[model samples]
Target: MTEIELNGSSAGLSGLTAVPWKNGSLNEALACYFCPQKTLQADRPKLGKVFTARNLSRIAGIEIRWTTNLADHLRLVDDDQVVFIFHCASFLQLQKSLDKSPFPDSFLQETLDTLALLFPSSDNETTNWLKSLTKIDPRLARCGSLRTRERRLENFNYWHDQLVILKQAFDESSPRNISQWWFDRRNGVQWYTFWIAILVFVVTIFFGIVQSIEGALQVYLSYKSIQSG
Candidate 1:
């Protein structure tokens, strides 16, 4: 099994090793495809409309066959021949659709979460796969560019940050230590709730202390009045 160093810890590359390709060849192929060289874009109109699996295939010049299994989808056989599968596994999964609008943060987070299940040990490979998926479609490729502005850049940043978060979550979820589980599992709402709970506790304690002081003062005043009477 191949190992990659992540955050000073060695992590196994189970996802890549599990592929059908030989270990040496798989590394070579991934290196070649994921190099810094810019991929050649097909001469096509900017993808502005809603994209379907069929039309997306037509535009990308690649056959994106639907697969019932997500494992088949994540495994890349070749650049031209690829299986485009979403995270859904049910019959209604295919009913899901995407449009020109920027993808919601929830959708992007879910997609990364799915990818992390397979590529848990390798953030580089996981991010590379994400980049490859974006490059396959002109619409995604164009919007993912650093030059793209408006909501497109926002969409790109959202996914990019989500990948970082996924990496952090994976690091925290390492088998060596499970104490940090809550660190990774926390979402915005969860964190908000956690802080609110702490705040409420502090307020309650403060009020309790104030009431004790007030009660003691009242008792002392009543005792003094009785003595005077």
Candidate 2:
């Protein structure tokens, strides 16, 4: 009987590598994209928004456009914030699956709680984190954890689509955010309404003062006439 060895080619190099993100990072930047997988798996975040905060950016050589729609500007602000967060925070730089077990439940809960406090802000951080953790290939959408071909393929396709959305949102534009809420020039109505409000305020104040002065003058005149009589 011949004993066959299975565990082969091993580059034996080991040391205590300093961990980058120590779980309290993403929230430190005050912005991030919540991972869909983490959210689904941990059930920590209950929000559906894209970003955790709004950011203004003026990167070198990037032309920032002014958007008339306040809502759209805010949507892009979310993107800017996410990108800024990614650059500033050490959240996603952690070693993927280097542990024997999945991410700690406590860590996941902490992340979820942090994100819960930052709901309604859409971001691409989580999206990027998921792609990295899964080690997804652009050419191959795959979940390394899954075993069944059906589940693996589905996850791969799903992640690929998510990556597309994440890229689109992140790569849409440069920072320089502009919001025209009540001051949109394109809407003549808003302009007219603004002036009309000012006019109304002035007129109301003017009439009120005039009425008081007139009443005082009338009373003075009556007293003077009585004294003269």
Candidate 3:
């Protein structure tokens, strides 16, 4: 019963201890691939884009270059060629469980909603899509109560995959709505204001120093004139 949690989301898997993702989590996912017997028992469909280490890497936002002593990197003949390597049973259990659950979408929707509130300009399309997803599949709308590891893992993977799919479609969608929009404007304004304030302060200090020097020179000249007289 390995347990895994990412970014505050938990995937509860029975009979598995949490094998925390270290360096090569992608490779670790690949190494954990199940045999046909196990996969079949789990009722995994054997068609159309079987998740590989590289694919999982993309999904997890991790780099292919990363690896650890616990897991080895995958070597493929070509980019298009598909390879099914062994992943930990716990990994499959978690991913499969998540694939069937709604928690992932619920998390995505909640996160998007919060972002929309905090950063209105950036998350418009994302927030709208999340809302629409909930409308289309209201089951996806509600968060799951804490459950057993098996249930949690299934739900977590289900929602995680859903979010990955949504993010990909969002990326490819028209005008690609992202959080970058809100940040770009705010960062530019802040930088501009910072430099402008620095410039004004410098100018004021420069004028003060010049006035002080002028006063000192005038006083020195007056004293000299008095001595001469």
Candidate 4:
């Protein structure tokens, strides 16, 4: 078991605190890589593997933290652990925001980009996980087992099917794309739609008023002409 000392306050290893891992030094490496500013001097709390549906958001936050703090040190960590963490984070993010109709395009694109970056190779544990998931739903066969990892998002139907399969497996209550096309409080989609509808209504009323004023003016001119005749 390799132990590494991580010190945020010092460039040298003088006041560094030694952090040990149960299995290997991968956990320490991850901690150093993600939370370099957090001091792990005394018996610091470790990230546990006991994840549940209720804790998905928290897990996603941890993963996001890792991504934001990522540096070249990522090359030194275990790929398997990295894949596991990314999968957990990405899946949880999708699950948490499933209620949003059509989904935010930016969010979806960012998630896909992160996936491509993290799982550049198709022969990794992530692909194997997807394969195992196929046993539960044959429809996931459309995902192609990541054979075309580079063009994973090209097939809309396949990508949608993958989302449906994962959602069913993890979160059942979230709405599908077509079901909730309008309101989404999380991403402020509902507010944007509401404001757009109000603007359209106001413009229509203004046009109607202008048309009425023109009709009244024409009628008055005709009456004046009849009087002159």
TM-scores for candidates 1 onward, in order = 0.26, 0.24, 0.26, 0.23
TM-score of model 3 (CA atoms) = 0.26
Task: Report the C-alpha lDDT of model 2 over 16-99, residue by residue, as the tens digit.
Answer: 111123345533312222223321231211222322222112221122332211112112233333321112012221323335
Better of 2 and 4 by lDDT: 4
- Give candidate 2's whole-model lDDT: 0.32
True-vs-predicted CA distance for residue 149, candidate 4, Å? 20
lDDT of 1: 0.37
The residue-by-residue lDDT of candidate 1 on 83-148, one tens digit each, is 334333222222234443132334444444333333332334334544556323222212121211
Give the Cα error of residue 8 in candidate 4, in Å. 3.3
**Model 4 worst lDDT run, 10 consecutive residues:** 61-70
Candidate 2, superposed: residue stretches over 4 Å from native: 1-183
Best by lDDT: 1
Report the lDDT tens digits of candidate 4 across residue range 1-229: 1124334232322222234333445644534333413121212122112122112222222121122111211221231112112233334254346774233444344444434433433334434544565223222222222233333323332133322232233222222342232322233675577668878999999999999999999999999999999
lDDT by residue for model 3 over 1-229, one digit each (tens)?
Answer: 2244444444654222233444456435423431111111122222112122222333322223321111121222233232112222233234445655322334333323322221233334333543543212222222222222322113332123332332232233221122323222324575467568878999999999999999999999999999999
Error of 4 at 45 (Å): 26
lDDT of 2 at 195: 67
Clash pairs for candidate 4: none
